[model samples]
Target chain A: MNDIYLDNNATTKCDPLVVEAMLPFFTEQFGNPSSLHSFGNKVGLALKNARKSVQKLIGAEHDSEIIFTSCGSESDSTAIMSALKAQPNRTEIITTVVEHPAVLNLCEYLETEGYTIHKLKVDGKGNLDMDEYKSLLSDNVAIVSVMWANNETGTIFPVEEMAELADEAGVVFHTDAVQAVGKLPIDLENSAIHMLSISGHKLHAPKGVGVLYLKRGVRFRPLLRGGHQERGRRAGTENVASIVGLGVAAELALQNMEHENTVVKAMRDRLQEGILAAVPNAFVTGNPDNRLPNTANIAFEYIEGEAILLLMNKMGIAASSGSACTSGSLEPSHVMKAMGIPYTAAHGTVRFSLSRYNTMEEVERVIEAVPPIVAKLRKLSPYWGESGPVENPEQAFAPVYA
Target chain B: MWDYSETVKEHFYNPKNAGAIEEANAVGDVGSISCGDALRLTLKVEPETEIILDAGFQTFGCGSAIASSSALTEMVKGKTLDEALKISNQDIADFLDGLPPEKMHCSVMGREALQAAVANYRGEEWVDDHEEGALVCKCFAIDEVMIRDTIRENNLSSVQDVTNYTKAGGGCSSCHEGIENILMEEMQARGETFMPGAIQKKKAKPAAQPLVTLETPEPAAAPAAGGMSAFQRYKKIEEVIEKVRPNLQADRGDCELLDIDGKNIYVSLVGACSGCQMAAMTVGGIQQKMIEALGEFVKIIPVDKAQYAAQLAQKQATASA
Candidate 1:
């Protein structure tokens, strides 16, 4: 069986069209965009066109506002550090508890460096408490870095409204829109969002490429200082091939966003419905409708996420769990913890993020393979004391087990 | 990502005896939820023969722990009581084609669950000297008799010696006092009584004598350092060393009492400790502090590189000529 991948939020396989667009940069159009030769000008014009494409996707007024970085984490670090540099006197930062570690860890490092940070709490539904957010906002606040949508929970935040509030408070607003862009419509022209971060690998583009949207009048210091690359904003040799790939991906996503909302969501909902019906003690872990249409996180009580992943690996079904990182710390996710999920349930969190390429047939196949695996782990789990078996372990596999 | 043997994965995926027997003649539960793993086992016996009729298990743990418990259930299903009671953790792992070294504790859990289940069947309870034995460290499934035997055999003379040998007093300091009490009792029983104030005399003198000999001389002079005034520092050092000796014996190594001025310990690493990279980590991480805490008056030292290199060179020159 070909493995079914449902971790698009973690990283995505590059689309074939994006790969095709990147080929010329590797073979025929290889040149330093900043060089004086004609070959350099040709590639430089290609880079310019790619920048224009990315600018159109986010609805940026000028192409010069976009700065390409290595990845979303780099973008986050650059934005936060630059904001602090721009307003050194303002030593306060306000962010939500559910921000990705890329933003959260940087915020923590900043706090240790004398920046006062206020982490707004999240409700059980994983939505940030806006009242506390408003209460914490002041002129001393340097920046409010909120994610457009949670990578783990997929709970969409009100970034526009928050940006407007930050504008009124004279605080810079940045959103890590790595999960939102390409899947959702982003109209930066109408919003007060001064800085936004988006990654390529998140939207079926190549890895090692990301875009940071800085408004034309925004003043920020450079995180990577060396050469005058990215017009002296970001310093690094251009990842020409991957940038081309990201440009194509952004164009495809702009064309496919509406269809993803409708078609992809239907498949995601069907998969969620089937999983809920087939397995006991399994429930979705985010806001049902407010979540990204392509994403669903579920917690299976009494069983750990690693054990479930082990079982899923046997059946050639690929998914991600929030239990253990490569570091082997068995701590539950901070995102889940911020939502007040108990460690037992929190460690069992598994994320299933679909893509435009995912199908209803694959969803059905997942539903067919999941019940027995969950049942087996539940039997050995001590949390659910002797609850017998789930309602039907053999429903999906009557012939084999019987 | 581990290169698990196919058989190990098979047993883990489809463990033979997994579930609970509705009406069981025996039941046992080991570990608690806070420790992150537990096992509940149930067994049924044939009325006439007392042979295990069926065995089933429920484990709240990682895959290996559950699989080990399930393996134990299968190992004892058809055995008589005495035969089943003799099964060790190694037996479970050997049956499952050898487990990873770190996961040996899983097999230990398997052995504990089976024993606990059988004891539950026979309605046996923990006792001071009931022969069936008492739980050693509830966190790691160690027992009292095992600790005593390890201490006596290894010649471990301190609380740290017992920890290195039996992994007791390794977690949650709540249990270290129990280990200390057990060590004291065992030492007293062996005619090595506690002493106070011998530490001041030892500090005053500058000769190298065996620490165990110094500790065993008198009980009154040793325990002068604290509210428990009879526990002498040198005596505690001897007690810890005596316990650790037999443990080193299992691996063909030996522990020696050290004498140093700036520090309380300075011992030669004769065999296995001479070359191992983790020798210092093992010593500094566990042994050094354990010995220091129990025996405050003596400094401990493993042989440094300069001394070890000279010894190696002398041996090499002797061999070459």
Candidate 2:
């Protein structure tokens, strides 16, 4: 039984190269970067090189612009809070409704703290409403935070153009690029995005390391204030080993960028097309042309996502669902709801996020395993058969059950 | 991932009695697609004996929910209508070994469907009295009566417990305060006080028990004497601090215990908590929690940094003398 992991959007397996690069930092290079001794200076230089590697991956102008934090959520918090604190008189924020909980939850907390939050709505294809977004931007708005690409549906938002709009209004624009940093080409040095957040684990790096890129001359305030670490922008001792791993992962991501665009995209499309062709009443959720190269969210009607995922798990194929039951909420994914997906289809949406490690053979295995599972679950569904009273179980049951 | 029991996995993977019964005397359907779980239960009854001749169910839900409906059907087969009505949600869960607390609502759905089916069999209107109660959790459309009954039936004690039993405050959490209010009212009506932070304290106690017992004489013996030892008091104070630390940390603040003299606890507020306007609330809430967990005489004093430094100096001076 082969184990096929397709839930890369949640987290990916760490690359061996990244782990090999980090091994020495845990034992041989154990000195704190803050110390004045030679041992510390050696570790400090390695940290500098790691920053440069990440800077090159994202096309940042200076290595000093990258502030390392604990994870993506911390970077997001720092960027949004710093923007708001820098402009105290501006008590309004503009964001979209389909943002990950890291941004949406903070926006909700800020709303209670007397900041007016304007949640831009999305269309049926999960595209942001640019007109509504533009109308909400003004002198009173302090910051505009949005994701570069959604984690669930893989819909890419126009952060580059939106940042330009924000800059014209003198507002700080930030993007949670956790999903887009490694998969897509980013040229932040030429873009107007004032701040961006990236997580290490989303790529092949280990967890517990993240980067917050602040363009030079951007007003900033630290979320954690104590030691003068990360140039007083973030306060915590460096997660030395994880940071080194992230740097190596960034370099690897840059090297494989083209392969990701072509091969991984092809495998993702194969899985999506095969599932759609085999199953009836199945369709992709996001915009096909503008989505991330490694994602495909397909909805199978008249069934639930959790059941589909469990049956797929039986086949050793791991995936994620946008169903409300799976999320521990009674409503489906906010991304699906924002797109106005009907209840029947939204309850049955499954997300298949590929990675550079995925192969065509693994994709083919998943494609072959999904149709029978969907058919079996739908056979048990009361809503599945042609629009009338269900047939008698006595007639439908096989001899073994009868 | 959910820690589903083996029984639940078995029932979900190879569910029994999954199809609809033809010429069924009674059919009951509950839940909607939007609610994330729904069930349709059908029963073939032996009219002369008033016993359920057979049962079948079709469920659209997660593994635990589907398993729960399947378990309900097996439990009710061959039982009289009255006997089947006595099959509570807990019985269904117990039949499946047990369910994660969050998935207990799936068992509740199964029980509700059973009641609806029984009502249909008796030719009686299944009155949804839930609509009469004020809507408490707007996200799940759960009303106050449903929360109250589940609380009473299960002896639930906290907002999280209520959520696990009824799924009332699980989404958005805008209605958590309302759920808390209902829980307090229910507890009070039953002549019990629902301490605000008791549930979390209870959850933490088991993990800390071995260490506490190893150091102290015995925590079990403290309640008998109304006066706790210094070590026991220290352990309790640490527990209280751990309980409030996350709330403080979320606001980028922290707290530390400076000293404890008898019933009074001196604490220092650090980070963002030092000059916060809600410093009083933070201190008062900690004091309330200590009093609730320890005893009524417990008090907390928020000592400033200068005062703490002076007290330390005075202690050193006394030691030298």
Tell me what TM-score chain B of candidate 1 gets against the true chain B: 0.45
TM, every model:
0.68, 0.78
Q: Which docking band does candidate 2 fall into? A: incorrect
Report the CAPRI category for model 1.
incorrect
List candidate 2 segments past 4 Å from native: A386-402, B131-224, B227-321
Query: Best DockQ goes to which candidate?
Result: 2
User: What's the DockQ for every one of the candidates?
Assistant: 0.11, 0.20
Candidate 1: Cα lDDT at B92: 79
Per-residue lDDT tens digits for candidate 1, residues A103-196, read: 9988987776788999888888888778888988898998999999999878999999999989888889999999999888988988899999
Candidate 2 lDDT, tens digit per residue, B1-321? 787889999999999899788868977777656756778889999889989989998876788878998899999999999999988776787789877756777887888888888888999867544344666776555878889889999888888678656657766678887787787888898999977863444322222223234555443343321355667768888999987888787757899888776556889898766755446767877886787677545678888868888978998899799
Candidate 2 per-residue C-alpha lDDT over A48-71 given as tens digits, one digit per residue, 9 for 90 to 100:
989999999999999999999889
- For candidate 2, what is the lDDT? 0.85
Measured by TM-score, the strongest candidate is 2
